[model samples]
Target: MLKILKYLKKSSISVVAIVLLLMVQALCDISLPDYTSKIVNIGIQQGGIENAVPEVIKEDDLKKLMIFIDANKQSQVKDYYHLIKYKDTESDSYKKNIDKYPALKNENLYVLKDIDKDELKDLNELLSKSEMALLTIENNKNQDNKIKESILKSFPIELSVKMKDKSLIEIMEYLPKEKTNAIKKEIMKKIEKMPDSIIEQSAIIYVNKEYKSIGIDMDRLQNKSILKSGTQMIAIAILSMFVTIIVTFLAAKVAAKLGKTLRTDVYEKVMSFSNEEMKKYSTASLITRSTNDIQQIQVMMVMILRFIFYAPMMAVMGIFKVVNTNVSMTWIIGVAVLFIVFLLSILFTFVMPKFKLVQKLVDRLNLVSREIITGIMPIRAFSNQEYEEKRFEEANRNLTKVNIFVNRIMSFMMPSMILVMNLIGILIVYKGTYSIDSGTMQVGDMMAFIQYTMQIIMSFLVIAMMSVMIPRASVSASRICEIIETNPTIKDSLDIKTFNPDKKGVVEFKNVSFKYPDAEEEVLSDISFIANPGETTAFIGSTGSGKSTLVNLIPRFFDATKGQILVDGTDIRDVKQFELREKIGYVPQKGILFTGTIASNLRYGNRNATDDEIKEAADIAQASEFINSKPEGVEFKIAQGGTNVSGGQKQRLSIARAIAKNPEIYIFDDSFSALDLKTDAALRKELKRKTSESTVLIVAQRISTILHAEQIIVLDEGKIIGKGTHEELLKTCEIYKQIALSQLSKEELGNE
Candidate 1:
């Protein structure tokens, strides 16, 4: 997975944008809870607008507020100046004040909150200190509550409190009676400037008038808060949606590009592989690696972009919000997250090995399927359809059984996650209810806690989901890497030279030998031969005599294990494979053809071949008669592998494709085996004249095919048994004589 992540560097800007958007979205989500708590705690719990302020503000408290207003020149308080002057609180002044300054009433109401916070704590302390000073001045003799009240009300509350206990007692005793009375009279004069109370029938009457004059409009406040919060939440949701779309699009684009690049890389690498490498990884496994394995990595790339980045962020932010709201309940999120991790760990450990095995099984299944599709006719002809079906079913069932086991384990993931979430929700509510009753939490706060907990759980759920796929994707990445990292055993040699010899179409093998990779013995050994320009060289031998293997070395399909093969005097290994193969037109024994028109298959050899050149080549290979007989002629369509055509026709077209290239050398590896004896004889007659200027090498089982060749090399067990024309071989070579006698009578040998 990490290997694939390197591809994401191209989209770094999108990644950063997605991250920023996620953060904004998360913060907005966290903000809604505070609004919920506020609406519940302030709007509904506190009664409507009428009861938003305290009823009984002391008379002295009002005067002190007025004095502070005067000193500060506060413009916000200027509208309430009438209250300072409205001493007759019992008259129409209360009603008139509400009618004159309705806006000021709401301001004054909420300002009480600030006033209560700023002045209330110190007010109680001031009252307590004043009582102590009064008692000390009276020498602990003031049992009369009224007299105590008079002394307390005589001076400024702050000033009286400031006088030390020793000073107050000394003032009462050391001062003369007249001086003491004069001091008391002066203090009383200062107190009289702001009257103790207005002309109300009682203190309760005074308190009622004040509350009616100034208090909050709670309905207005709640509506405004709800509107603001709702708008914010909607905006956040829209932004989050846009971010998700962008992230998804970018992730898909990256995955597709990664898959395309990986496929291209694998294909180009495979194209460079020698037969040794091709054998190392079978055709079916390579197909799986290129297609199925790449798909796995592509899917994982999307999940990494969309979930891997998002889950951790959400989990961390959710945990932060949870701890911020109620630290005690944080353990609930932790326990849930831990449980999810444990569950995922158990499943991943068991299923990951299976995921790797599944790919191999898929390869096996593909190999069987391909074999059945390619060889269906043979299976039917041999009456082994049921056997083939059973073989395929066995492979299919093995893959199916493993898939079911893995899926059965994975199916529990979603339900188990939901179960954990529900159980945690119940646990949170159970604990939160007690906290709410104790006044430490509120209903809205509990609801927000639940949301945060869900977010945390969802984060872990994302991780759990990813855990299931990451192992599989990781296995796929490694498989793809295995193909990509493989170095072809056969590659172009350094200091490569061009092969533009004067004697074109010359091929030579000097002491050549080859062994299959990991084989105990060589398939071909110490073979030496040369096919000169404008001459035919053919090999005839029994089965497993390295007939096809020796010819394969000419094109470097598999490099010679010992010694060297040369084309036009240049070592084939030292020339680039593409350059070397370009001069040689090879037709495999099976006569493979791609899906296209006859022209397209022929053009595969030379895209620039003219109509006349195509017709001439087909004529030389005895393919023009059948090709012209068709309704479309040269434009006739051919099915893949030429399955729609007869075996003889397919082989003729294959020869014609090679002939159209007009290459310097032609290799026919049993290419004429499919044709009838007459068609074969006629085709060879035309081929000899057409390729008279090229080096022609043929591997054939029939004595008739190579009897006319200028040089026929007979091989047996990787060693050359004979090297001469047919008549000379029949006279000198035992193995060649045996092969000739089996295919032709003594009279036919005499005619040759």
Candidate 2:
């Protein structure tokens, strides 16, 4: 998978954009839980009173709070509050305050002034502690002896007894300033030791009472806070969703573009491969690499773009939020993550090996299916349809069994993850209930912790899913890279040579020995031959005598193993393959045609060939009769491989395509075997006239097909046993005479 990412260089800008968008998406996702916590903790549980520092407090209430506040901090707190008198209705600020806080109409109120977040936070901390201390002392006045003892431990013995009778504020009023300051300092120390959450809750309770006294609508305040937080949550959600859509679109585009680029590179690489390379990789395997294997990489690319970066960011951010929300519950997330890793580790052990096998099985199934489809006629003729069915079934069943096994293992992952997630949720809530009851954790904070835990777990889940896909895609990437990285066995020389204009239409093979790759013995050895312009050179041999192999050398499908083959006075290896093949028109042992109109197939040899040229070539190949029979004529559609046409007609069309090329050399490699004698005779006779100025090479099985050739080479094994015209070879070459005798009578040979 990493190997394939180099193709994404073209899409680097889009990938960067996707990364940025994924970060935004992660931020939004991680923030939502924090908002939910605020809504629950502040908006509902605290009646929308966010902190210990009240926005507006009655002047008398403010004085009560000041009694508990330290002298040094009291001046700073008073500086942030403005005294609004009920009689100051003429003032614009008093008018606004009276309308907002109606309690201003009854008494003077102290409204908090604007301050920076740091200052506000300091004020909130100080006031929250002071409010809690004051409330504790007042509550202790009527409590039982045990409760009073715990509350009064920090106070002096005389003050502790006085705290049980006189209210805290009255006792503070009577005491000297030095003594009262000392008592306040002691109470502050005790309050400082208390949990910050408990202090904030206690402060908000006092703030709620202050608001009620000031004629503030408590329900409206709570509703407004909830609505504002809910709106922000919805907006973040929509924004995250929008970012997700764009990320998905960009990721898909990058993956699809990469797929297209890979397919093209693989196809072009395969096209450049020599026959030796073709033999190294089977046709079915190449097909899979081009399509299914590439598809696997494409899917993995999207996942990598979507989750590879995003998952880790989410996991880290979620962990940070979890830690900040409450540290105690973080253990639940750690254990859940460990278990998830263990689960995935077990899955990988069982499933990774199978992924590689699945791709091979797909190749096997495709190979079997292609063979059965292409050979259906042969199978039916041999009455072996059932045997072929079993072969296909075996391939299919093997593939299916592996797929099911892999799927079963993967199927176990999601439910198990969900189970772990649910169990973790239960444990968090169960553990959180104790913290909440103990006044250490708030409801909102616990809820947010649960959400963050789930988010963190889900991030691991995404990584786990990608872990499975990455191994499979890595296998696919290796296969694709094999094709893309392979250097063709046959390549043009760096110092390329061009053909000599004076030596056009000349082909020479000097001591040419050929063998298939990895073969021990040469198929053709020490062969030497030359075919000049305006001449016909024919090869006749038994089935394995290297006749077709000899002609195939002219086009350089496979380079000669032990000798040099040259065309137009230049070594074929020194010239580009395209330039080498362009001068020759070759029709293989079997006729092959692509899916297109008949005219298009004919023009395939020379795309610039005119309609008249097409018809003329067809006429020369003796195919005009059948072509004119169809209503579409030259426009008649040809199925792939010309399967829609008869064998003879397909061969004639193949011959016509070669004729349409009108090249300097023509190779007819048993291309006439499918035709009847009459058509073959007529085509050869016309071909002689049409190619009178060009060189022609023929590999034939029938003696009648090459009896009139200018030169005939007869091969007994890989060696050329006879070379001469028919009449000359019949007299001098015993092997030629016997082959001629087998195909024709003595009178026929004498006549030729």
Candidate 3:
């Protein structure tokens, strides 16, 4: 996977943008739970009161609260609230506040002035503790003697007994200033020990009663708080969704563009391979690398862009939110994460090895399938269909077995993760119930903690899924890289040399020896020959006599190993492969055609060829008979590989394609084996007349194919044993004489 990183440089800008958008999405997702906490804690439970600091209080209630407040803090608290007397109700300021606080018509009110968040927070803390102390003393005044004893212990015993039946405010009026201050100090000490949340809850109850007294609508306040938070949640969700869509779109585009580029480069690389390189990689493997392997990487790229980057961001942010929400339940998330990591580690150990095998199995399956399809006729002719079926089934079953095993292992992931999540949720709620009952945590905070914990676990799940995909995609990336990175065994020299224009149509091999890349011995050894313009040079030998290999070297299909093969006095290797092949027309042993019309296949030789030139070439190769007989003539559609046509017709068309090229040299590599004696003789006669100015090289098994050639070379094993025209070879070369006698009668030889 890392090997393909350079290819991703073109998409760097989009990738960076995706990263930024993923951060935004993570932030939005992390924020939603906080709003839920606010709605539950403040909106529903506190009657929409966010803090313990009352916005408005009756003047008498404010004085009652001030009794418990510290002397230093009382002045600051009083400074934040202004008195509005009933007499002032007629003024503009009082009139403006009257509708909000309708009880202003009967009593003087103390309304809070504008304050910053820091000051408001300080005031809330100060007032929350004071209000809790007042509420505690008042509620305890009516309780049993034991509870009242704890509160009355601050006063004298006789004084406390008389004050037991009085209200807390009345008791305070009976005590001296020093005694009252001492009692208030003791009450504040007890309230300070209580949790901040409990203190705030108690204070909010008192504030709610004050709001009721001031004619403030509590229902409207609660509804507005809920609605505002809900709207913000919805907006953030939509924005996160929008960012997610853009990220997915950009990821897919980058992956698809990379896939296209890889396919094209793989194809061009394969096309440039010499025969040696072709033998290094099988056709089926190359197909899998270009198509299936590349597809795997493309899919993985999208996952990488979406999950790889986003999952970590979410995980980190979620952890931060979890820590900030409540530290008590964080252990549940920690245990859950450790268990998941262990599960993923075990899975990785077992599954990583199989990913490599799966790609190889796919190659095997494709190879068997392609061989069976291409050789179906031969298999049917030999009555071996059952054997081939068994071969195909073996490959298919192996692939299926590996895939099922891998899938079965992967299928365990989601349910196991869900089980962990469920168990973790149970543990958090069980643990959180105590905190809530003890007044250390609220319902809203616990709920938010659960969500944040889940988000953290979900991030790990995304990473686990990608971990499984990465190994397979990594294998695929390596396979694809093999094709793109390979250097062909045959390449043009860095200091390229052009052909000698004055010596056109001349091919020479001086002590040229050749061997396959993997072979031990040379297929052609110490071979020397020259075929000049306006002459035909032909090679004939028994099977495996280096006939085809000898002719193949002239086109530089495989460079000569021991000696030089030159064209027009210029070494073939020194010139570019394209320029070398352009001057020679080559016809392989098998007649191959693409899926197109006859005109198109013929035009492939020379795209600029005119209709008259095409007709003349077809007529010379004896292909015009079958071509003109068709309803569409030259426009007749040719099936792939020309399978619709007979062997003889395909061969004739192949020859016609080469002839249409009108090159300096023509190579017929046993290309006429399917033609009959009559057509062969006629085609040869026409070829001799038309190609009289071009050198021709032919490889043949039958002696009649090369009988009329100007020069004939007979190869035995890897050596040339004879060279001459037909009559001279029969008189001088025993192998040539024996080959001729076996194919033709003495009377025919004499007549020739």
Candidate 4:
């Protein structure tokens, strides 16, 4: 995890920003439980109804609130009865003061609808009844006072205190308090001081205010607790989600980048090695390292981004929370966790070695699959479908058998974890009963703790799940690293100078010797030879005679261990490998081709090769015939590895690729083995004419193949048995004489 983090730190700003986002998200998530505690203790416990809200809803502005609707109609009727009598007296006074003519303000006039005095009195009686019910509910002294204030604010003070217009909420806020008694006395005095006629004839305005969250009454113990807990959990969940996404994305990006970088490094290292060195590791193993191993590492990185911090934090915090409960049940859970770890650890320990064997088996299976596909033509020609199938089945069966066993072992982990959890759950329930009886635990507290315990156990289970992949991926990483760290036996010169490839070709071997790594004897011993401008020097020998190995050195595919190889009088090593290789055109024994058009293959040697140059090269290599047969000509698409083309066509195309380079020296290591005699003869004729100014080296099995060469070298077991013209070799060297007699007619050998 640390290593992955360090890699991500290479892009510090982005990583840090994402990490911050994750932290913020986690903060939100953690806030949930804490908020739950608040809701339970404060909102529900206190019965803050005005602020109370449902669990699913979110409103914070709500405070103590109530809505009182109706007023006391009975009190209004009694007041109306008195007001009629007072109004008669007021009317008499008005008549007496008519001469004074005092004007009435609109505020003092009646705002109520006109009604018969008897009907107005009846409505007042209903209003008084409604007010009594409201006041009756809030009969507490404190409540009455608040109700009195609610009415004063909701209505005109004249309407509320005088009982002219009333509100149920105002009555609801009414508390039976000492202050209520004093306020009521003062209100009665003010009402009496006003004429009763004014209260009976006039109406007043009042307002009712409502709060949605507060309306639900979260102040109740159960409701408030649930609301607050839910809010906190929601906040926590949001934070967790935010943190998870940020971390997972960042970790995945970093892991992918590292994988790509590691891939590049591995490729460079492997590419630096010669053919012999490349043969040391199988292709499947290399692929697994690049893809499978990298993916495993990538997954680990993703998890670390999301849960690395969370896993440990949850484990530790859960432990603390659980332990603080101080219930006797702690030991049971601890033992269960320990047993689970031990069981899983043991299971993994036994399976790890078998998993490695599975990887090897998979490599073998891939090798077989590759061979069957590559050698499809041979397999079909030999009618070996069943034979190859059996081989493939054998290899595949070995892999499947081991993989099944691995799956079987792995399959046990989750169930075993669950089983352990269940057993521990039983113990917890049993122990929880005792704690409850002893007052060491509450029902809700035990419920929450049990939930937390499950979370802790699951986290460990997840860790165990991830641990299973570690050993296999570790092996793969080591394998990949090993390749990347290896120093190639062939290395580029540190101090290289520019060189030209246009000079007259004169390649010389000065007692060159080379031994493959881990081999007891040198493959080529004391090989000293020269091929000058406008000449062909061909090597002919039996199998294992170092023919191809000898030509390989001239190109520096592998450096000679004991001697110097020079080109144009300068040591080839000092000339720079690219320049040295650019001067020599080589065609290996097996023609290699990638999936592409004919024109693309021809351009492999020189990207800048023109159409005319490609045509000319194709003509010289005898590839023009097959290429012209296709309707698309140079645009003809080839299958992967040249599978679509005939063996001879593939060889011709390979030759054309080298020919397109038009290098100073051309090396053909039995590149013509697949061609027919007529095509071979035509190709040689074309090559000889086209390469009149270039040196050519050929490694062949047939004497007829190199019969017309200016010089021939024969090898027997890595030593030069003879070096002369073809005729001279048939007479001078016994090994060459045997090879000549085996491949040539008497007439051909007689001239030799």
Better of 2 and 4 by lDDT: 2
Q: CA lDDT of 50 in candidate 4?
A: 18
Cα shift from native, residue 407, model 4 (Å): 1.8
Candidate 2 segments whose C-alpha is farther than 4 A from its true place: 143-167
lDDT of 3 at 72: 86
Cα RMSD of all models vs. native, in order, equals 9.4, 3.0, 2.7, 14.5
Instruction: List, residue by residue over 28-117, the lDDT tens digit for candidate 2.
Output: 999999899989998999998888989998888778888877668889999999888899889988978777888778799888899999
- Candidate 1 structure quality by residue, lDDT tens digits, 215-304: 434356456656665666677667767767777887788778889888998999999888888888999999999999999998888887
lDDT of 3 at 587: 90
Task: Supply candidate 3's per-residue lDDT for 543.
Answer: 90
Q: How accurate is candidate 4 locally (lDDT)?
A: 0.68
Clashing pairs in 2: none
What would the per-residue lDDT of candidate 4 be over residues 527-622, giving only the tens digit for each residue? Answer: 998898899999988889899888998888888988888887777787777778888888999998888899999899899999999999999988
lDDT of 3 at 509: 89
- Where does candidate 3 have its weakest 10-residue lDDT segment? 141-150
Instruction: Show how many residue pairs clash in every candidate, following the order shown.
Output: 0, 0, 0, 40
* C-alpha-based local distance difference test score of model 3: 0.90
